[model samples]
Target: MFKLLLFCFLIGITVGIGLLTTFLYANTSIVNQVFLRDKYSKLQCIWLLVFLTGCSLLLYYTFSSQALYYSLIFMNPSLEPLQFWDALWVVGITDFVVKFYFMGLKCLILLVPSVMMSHKCKGFWYMCLEEISQYYCTLVSTPVWFRYLIDYGAQTSRAEWHFGILLALLYLIIKLFFVFGQWKTSADVLRLFFTQPSYGMAATKRQCSEAEDICAICQAEFTKPIVLVCQHIFCEECICLWFNREKTCPLCRTVISSHNHKYKDGATSLQLRLF
Candidate 1:
């Protein structure tokens, strides 16, 4: 199984790189269009480069551990140890490379909208929050405008005041807490985009006592766990129902005070809901 997965990873990395490279080379016009639209400063460019490298390393490290964990299963079995070691080597390296390529794909599709929104706004912070709120709302309601609103902060969403508070707090953090504000600028925007993935997935990250990936309410494993801003992952249905009745998150006991529904991207981001 490990060997097969490794082989698949190699194939995926090859295909991903080939596909993205072709897109870049073939559609030079589109590439130029994106650059023109999202013109980053030298500092921002350096930050992005450093950030991507770090994230890639993190992904590689995480998946490598997973690979090692899976390989241990073979050690206890009657499998050929030498063959298994070879398989682990091939698969682990391939997994890292594929993740690298996939990150590039994400940059093309996800980064543009996020960066463009980040740069163009007067209310970068709250707009970021509202963007997250919309993303969270889409997971459970089956509403007509779920995806559209989350990505765009629909007519009903409180994007204006949402962005307002964010901007004000950001200003306060930067002005008063200047020493700890090195990450405030880019972090404000990233906190918004990732807090609510622009896709239809509701992946809020709140904490749950159980690690089984089963919803406490329904006791069903989610097809995709909705990670709330709370660093908790749960069945989307459970959290949605919980959020609707009580203005508090289920696991963390954090008040769901803001109808705006957004937090940052850390354990300290304060367990909050975006959708």
Candidate 2:
């Protein structure tokens, strides 16, 4: 009865946490919009604090569970049965807490400066957070092949550790190559945005007459209108702002250019497929 009750309690906590996270994520756009428009708000500050606290709690839980699982698997054979509280105290405090501290430190390094900088840097911190979240999720939900490799390594003798380490290093090297490729692609896109007028050509009178006179982005009369490949016309300044956050034609969703980086929303995807 006690075990069943404990399980039920855990499930309830998990569901509640999931719901809270979803709600916070749903409101992120509103928070960003408010921050950009108004500069600051007391309620938005509280919401951000709550969201960050929730993230920290989730990180703690993940690290604690991982530490406990590994500790159980690798407990000294000669050591008597591990006491739950003792193991939790020793492993959780030493290993999990240290790991969580470093993770939090990384986040602060990425975020603190952006917050302290000009209001124009609003999207920068959000993009950094998204990248960090993507990396965290990828680490926690490793590929099946990598899991199998880790399991084999865990079960092997000390002599096999070197071989496993070598394999892990090789895997990291290959992954780094892909990451480099992505970085290169991003650099090209950045160059295109700066050095070239890839947004579009100036809209001719004929083009302007055919398309809407008002820029879709700013919802105002077009100034220095540029017609994109999709035949949609927008103000150069308005389209530039839109392209900063999106690479698609606002009307038709056509990709802006071949140099456009692979993006979902404004955040660049760091996800890689092992298969």
Candidate 3:
């Protein structure tokens, strides 16, 4: 009966979180705009507060639950059922809290530094972190027998933690190598956009006429327009903004350049599935 109740509670929590996440994702654009704007309605502010509170609670509960479960498994390899109070005692007195604290600290270490970095490098670093975390989750989600093997090995020696630290260090080194390459590419794209005459050339009267004297991006008359290789014309500012997030012409979808653009606004999703 206890197990059944616990399972039902987990299911209910999962369903509720999932529904909330779906709603937020569906209105992601509106949420973003509301948060970014200097002035927003009172309701929007309330909703934003609710969103942040939900995220904080979710993170807290997830890490706490994971730590409790892992500590239980480490203590009782056979996974014996326990009374609710017994489980709570194990969670409080064991290494669970320490592990949970470190997990949260590690996330902050990864996120705070990236947030402080320049816009050009922030997205790349975030992407690298996301990849590393996805790989970690894949390892964590391996078969139960594999996890047991890991646990057994960990119990035998302290080398497992050292090995994990070394592995993470090596991965960071490799990712840093790629980061430099990406930074160079982004710099070159910026230089080309600003320095190249072809990219910023003024649209002639004939070109403007051919484009119906309008910039398709802003849905208004052309202003300091530029023509692309695909013959699509747009306001230089408008196109520059578009190119920051995309690599193709907005209208024809033709490849604008071989170089990739940095993420727009240095913004990235904070959902790191470390479990």
lDDT per residue for candidate 2 within 244-268, as digits (tens), equals 5567898989988654432212332
For this target, which candidate reaches the highest lDDT against the unseen true structure?
2
Off by more than 4 A, model 2: 1-46, 57-163, 189-198, 201-213, 216-219, 223-232, 237-256, 261-275
lDDT of 3 by residue, 1-275 (tens): 99988986786567446634633452353334322322334454345445544554564465465343454234332233343333333333222223222233322322333236422343344334333333333233222322333343354468874564565555556555755655654555455434432344677999999889888877999977888888788887577656657888888788876654432322333333222
- Name the weakest run of 10 consecutive residues (lDDT summed) in model 2: 71-80
All candidates' lDDT scores? 0.40, 0.48, 0.47
Query: lDDT of model 3 at residue 227?
Result: 81
> After aligning candidate 2 to the native by TM-score, how far in Å is the CA of 44 from where it should be?
4.4
Residue 231: error of model 1 in Å?
A: 23
- Candidate 2 vs. true structure, TM-score: 0.44
Q: Which is better, 2 or 3, measured by TM-score?
A: 2
Better of 1 and 3 by TM-score: 3
> RMSDs, each prediction?
25.9, 9.0, 10.7
Q: Which window of ten consecutive residues has the lowest lDDT sum in model 3?
A: 93-102
